[model samples]
Target: MSHENKTIRNTAPGHPRRPLADRIALVAGATRGAGRAQAVELGRAGATVYVTGRTTRTRVSEVGRTTETIEESAELVTAAGGTGIAVPTDHLDGERVRALADRIDREQGRLDVLVNDLWGGEHLLVGSVFGKKSWETPLADGLRILELGVRSHVITAALLLPLLIRSDAPLYVEVTDGTAHSNRRYRENMYYDLAKTAPIRLAFGLGQELAEYGGTAVAVSPGFLRSEQMLAHFGVSEENWRDAIAQEPAFAVAESPQYLARGVAALAADPGRAARWNGKSACSAELARAYGVRDVDGSRPDAWAYFEAAAHGGEEVSPEDYR
Candidate 1:
């Protein structure tokens, strides 16, 4: 499918007016998933977005997924009505990230928003075990995950802080999973949990650190995200995703990554968004309620709430039933 076909029109009742135009945004890891959706949504709001990732038309990353490319992401952003600049970047290399930031500084002279969505843990966790006992995964793989997931965000933030500080409404968003205090353990192997949690804490630390710089930092998670990978994994397309719900009940409430993307755009547009910052990790459903934006299906899916209810024996639904 083409990117233009994926573009969603704003047809929901009581949809708010466009508030972001001529803003500058940087969406790291924009090759796919939430990063791609966020880039397109920011573009839809009329922002010049810099979409950075390792996967481009010229080369592919270690993950080997080839459904999307940095160039394709950039095109989708442009189709959404904003300038999209695709810069192939391996976030592990600090110098490359710095160079991209320098170019942004030279050209735009300011940045309105920065989103760090870099993650490369899927391949590493393929054969890992996480049953009765936790085994120490390979230190090398663990460190690599940290490099892509955590250190990249720190380096990007450091390189772009100056430009972000120049914006009237500077926002730093850390894309992560779950809220801060959610004690639920991820069934994934050991390294995956550590990699994901580190970014959440980084957001907490940065939110405190950036307070004096007049920038807001917050961790945002998509609820049961129906990402491109997940859709393919379930053998379904977004247009016919409802068919998959017959196999997994939660699929009935699965949210598109674009829903979270719109939430990030809305947060960036809010002038007092900083007040809601600080260690707080929000889900797309919560942000949708707060921002009054509807999902493409016109129904907000609260995945966290569903999980909580199911865990507490409040809901009898099963994953298969939702599918």
Candidate 2:
């Protein structure tokens, strides 16, 4: 409990310290869902966050998904207690990505955290790609999925890594879907599997080089995230998320995106964070145990542990043990 005073773990009404004060962070793909949560949570810990994505208040990206905008994400970050700057730029475009880095350098001078949360492959995830054989899947769609899910992450990191390196304590988080253990089961098809696992390898390879510059790189997974997209998919609001259990029983284990992002904030706040988590693939559930964060309901939900035992292992264990 050493970080009890530093984190919002047990102190609730008594604790009032923001451990990440003055920290500068960039959360790519912060238009909504996990990315937005990560940005807001970082701001909650007092970090000036640059929330970037292709969508804005005025226009949508090529993906054409509307409703949530980067501008709104930035406003939420600012409301959470830190300065938030909304920059609309597609990560795939090299010039636009570099320009974003330059703007950060001019405004903040240093970046402490770089979160590669940009993934535009939602269509491939739940679309016709599922259950369709690799040979039968549309070639263009498969390539598009790879381009968004894998390449965007690489492009963003390449342009932003220099700014992150300037900070004394830098953290690069590859926000992904599943942990190393879980992803071994295969994610949909060839394209989806490669896209999801590429970031894990990206974090690993980057960790080795980052060691020289005193930086940390890790891939973090959110367990059954009830993201904005997921809520829309299930046709349930946060207050009515439980209702989705009728449609998909597995949804019973779903956790809010805020829970996962809080774990990211805790990782950024830990001074010895690199020593423990560099090059690692961690889940939000376990991180919540180590950190002092909770879901929207104020409970630390260990969704992965529950998944491991009940879903994967088929072991009958008390739900209380995991959550």
Top lDDT prediction, candidate number? 2
lDDT of 2 by residue, 182-270 (tens): 88887768888888899999998889878877789999988888988789889999999989978986677788989989889888878
Badly placed stretches (over 4 Å) of model 2 are 1-16, 316-322
The TM-score values for the models, in the order shown, are: 0.87, 0.91
Q: lDDT of model 2 at residue 24?
A: 86
- Scanning candidate 2 in windows of ten residues, the lowest lDDT window is 1-10
RMSD of each: 7.6, 5.8
Weakest ten-residue segment in model 1 by summed lDDT: 1-10
State residue 125's C-alpha deviation in candidate 2, in Å: 2.7
Using TM-score as the measure, which candidate wins? 2
- What lDDT is obtained when candidate 2 is compared to the true structure? 0.84
Task: Estimate the overall C-alpha local distance difference test score of candidate 1.
Answer: 0.79
